[model samples]
Target: MDGSFENAAGQARARVALRWRRIGFSALVLGSCAALLGLMAATLFVEAPDPVGIAMLLLFALTLPWTTIGFWNAVIGFSLMTFCRDPAGLVAPHLRSIGGTEKIASSTALLICIRNEDTGRLQRNLGWMLEGLVASGESRWFHLYMLSDSNQAPIIEDEQRVAAELSARFGSALSITYRRREESSGFKAGNIRDFCERWGSLHQFAIVLDADSVMTPAAMLRLVRIMQVQPHIGILQTLVTGLPSASPFARIFQFGMRLGMRSYTLGAASWQGDCGPYWGHNAILRIAPFTEHCHLPVLPGKPPLGGHVLSHDQLEAVLMRRAGYEVRVLPEENGSWEENPPSLPEFIRRDLRWCQGNMQYFHFLSLPRLLPVSRCQLGLAIAMYLGAPAWLGLMTLGLLRQMPIRADLGALLFILTMVMSFAPKFATLADVLARSPLRQAYGGTARILVSAFLEMLFSMLIAPISAVAVTLFMLGLPFGREMGWSTQQRDAEGIPFALAARRLWLQTVLGFVFAVCFWRVVPGAVWLWAPFVLGLAGAIPLAMASADPRVGRALAAVGLCRIPEEARLPAEPEYATLFAPCAPLSPTGATE
Candidate 1:
């Protein structure tokens, strides 16, 4: 009785502490956003604010919360990375209690959800993971389920052959199951649901993986052990980094992503605590709670924004939280990876799908019994896509309004905004450069700096292009324009010039129009909008060049934008073939 009372008291105290952390984090984010918005208001209304100026301020205001939250996350993350002994442990104390020798008593289902995908690549990723797990002697505690929704006969046959090969290779060392659905009713979520209904009872936990996801056995063991020890956690998401890619577009894009994600995730996890994000894949879920309470609701419509939830991860997280379970992210970049889109066109296609799915979150904002943070998360997801249109609106309005302003203050504000916008990447970059080990891991200071500079340029070019695409997609969401769930092109194939031109014609035309208008109306300040204009104007060529095989080869040859995985051989011999194409070239032009 006394021990129970002490335990209850400890829980109470922890709850109070968490509440305070949430309050403090909220105060910081809201306060920072308010201050920035005030500055923008002052800048816009220096003279009496007209309707256009007011509209610009409103749009600018809309863009702030996301940027401010990200900026603060980066700042806090950088501080932790620089100052703390164990930054991830500080955020997730449960992780500190995990000793590597812990027994994996809990049964975990490794669910690899796939659509029509490249089975060869899938086979390699799955085989390595299974081999690692088997070697760890924890194969008995885990099961592999290849849940496929492949409609193509060829791909389906390939998936079967791959599954057969893996089964034959592993023999009885690991349990492997392959299931395919004739109709992908709920898309990926439905596929998962079918698994839950059929075999979820067999496992205590599920580590969800996309077709492109690959996790080392050690990482899988860590997640399993953490879940085994901490039964209260519903979801534990790993910080999945991009795999080394030979594609120039993917390399540069993921390099920027790698820089930003570390700080952003760490900082967000610090405050988000139990209300952390679950990014669909590369995460472990408590099967019981996830199956019992986290079933997705079909929205009241058809396709796109309606029917089955496309962005099912967050909603599942919310539901799990509502069921009184902690949803968390392990912010350390361990041996977990996923392939990014190989080119600009594929990237846009993926981004639009997310945009469409995020827009569906509007229906859940008013959900009952949800924690405030959960609602805020849903709102932020919506705002993420909404900010694209808001940014475009601000630019369009700025061009049209051409309001008289003090150049120095305006420029200062613009600089501040840009700094905050890129703070996550900058924060992680600073951390990387500050540590000698990190610099060496990334192939030294000179290479890191060069890669970062080039990546910055790539980011600037891609941002406006993505924004325009998202804005256009968002505009069509209300009119029944659906980005259907389809097989993603994962290969780093060169995009044809005609294909690029066809896809980005609107962006190019809009860029030309903006340039003409900026020159005619505000020629003196045309440089102010150069980044956005040039990105739009050169959208087609940029897409083609970024996706060009020669460009990728050139970048690879020079060791530019190389990730750590590319600099050295993977610890596991099985990954050698996978990383060979991404490996740095020797002085003699051979792969080092």
Candidate 2:
């Protein structure tokens, strides 16, 4: 009884420390945003403060929080990466105790959620993970569940076949179960709910994996061990990186993402602490709490912004936290990865879906019992999509008002904003260059520099295009523009010019219109709007070129935008096999 009291007191003290840390971080973020907003207001209103200028300032204010948060997160992340020996351990203290030899005491269900995916790829990924787990000598504590939402007859048959093959191969060494829902009621969330009702009671933890997700046995073991010791943690999300891709779009996009995520996640985790993000997949959940408390509520409407919650991860995280459990992120780029969209069109499609989902969070802002941090997270998620429209609105206002004046302050603000926008990637790039092993892992300083330069250009081009797409989509949400749940095209494939043109014609036209308008009114300021205008105008061609197999092959051949996983064979033979086809060839035409 005395020891229990001491433990409770210690926990109370820790909670107080965490609360103060949150308050400090909140102050920092709010202060930075306030300063930036003031600067933007002064820059706009100092000359001839008009209603249009005020409107532009309002839109600019909408854009400040996201950029400010990112900039600060990058700053904090870079400092930790450069100065601390154990940054991940510092943020996620539960991880420090995991030494890889912990005895597995809790039952964990490896939930692989699928909906009409490539069966062959699924088999290979699962086989590799299962083999690794068996080799780790802890297969008994883990069970594999193929929870399918595939309704198509052929795809269902394929899923069953793959599951049966995997079960036969593993035999008694591992347990594998396959369950398919005839009607995918709540989509992925519903599929997970079905699993909870059926088998969640049997397991203490569930390591959720998307169809495209692949995790090394070591990563899984580490997660399980952390959960065993830190019973307070309800969800633990791994820092998921992108797999080596043959697609030029994916290669460049993920290179930037890889750089940005390390610093961004580390920084966010430092402040976020227990109320971290859950990105749907590549994370582990405590089955009992998740099943009991995280059942998503159907919104009080119809399709689009109603019905079931599309972005269930964040909601689940908040719910889990509301249940007095911690939702944390590991922040370390361990052996966990997922496939990225291979082309601009696919990327836009996936992104817009998220936009629609995140926009739905507007309904839950005043949700009862949610922590302040939890509410802040939801607001941030909403603001993320809202920034696109806000940016476009600012652009529209600039074009309409055609206001001319102080170039000095305008240029300074522009430069500073751009710097803040790209801080995360630049921060990580600096850290990588500073470390020898990291530089070598990413294929030396020269290659890394080239990759970074190209990726920066890629990001500039993609950002405007995505912003425009999101702006248009959000505008159409009221008229029932819904991106219903569907099977994503996971494999890299060429996007036809005709298809690209059909999809991106509006962006193309809008780009040219903006360019011509900016050129006519403010010819000198064309350089200022060049990135956005050029990206919009060149949308179709950019989409087509990025998805061209020849372009991908050319980039791969020269080792441009190569991830570390592509430079050297991974320790896991399975990863080697998976990445072999995408590996760069030597000058002699042999795989290097």
Compared with the true structure, all predictions reach lDDT values of 0.88, 0.89
Candidate 2 residue-wise lDDT, 472-577, digit = tens = 8999999999998888987778788899999899999999999888898778876689988889999988988887766777787877777778755655455686
TM-score of 1: 0.97
* Residue 216, candidate 1: alpha-carbon lDDT: 87
Tell me how far the alpha carbon of residue 312 in candidate 1 is from the true structure, in angstroms, after superposition: 0.6
Please give the distance, in angstroms, between residue 241's alpha carbon in candidate 2 and its true position after superposition: 0.4
Q: Which residue pairs clash in candidate 1?
A: none
Enumerate residue pairs that collide in model 2.
none
Q: Estimate each model's TM-score.
A: 0.97, 0.97
Provide the global lDDT of candidate 2 against the true structure: 0.89
- Candidate 1 deviant stretches above 4 angstroms: 1-8, 570-574, 586-592
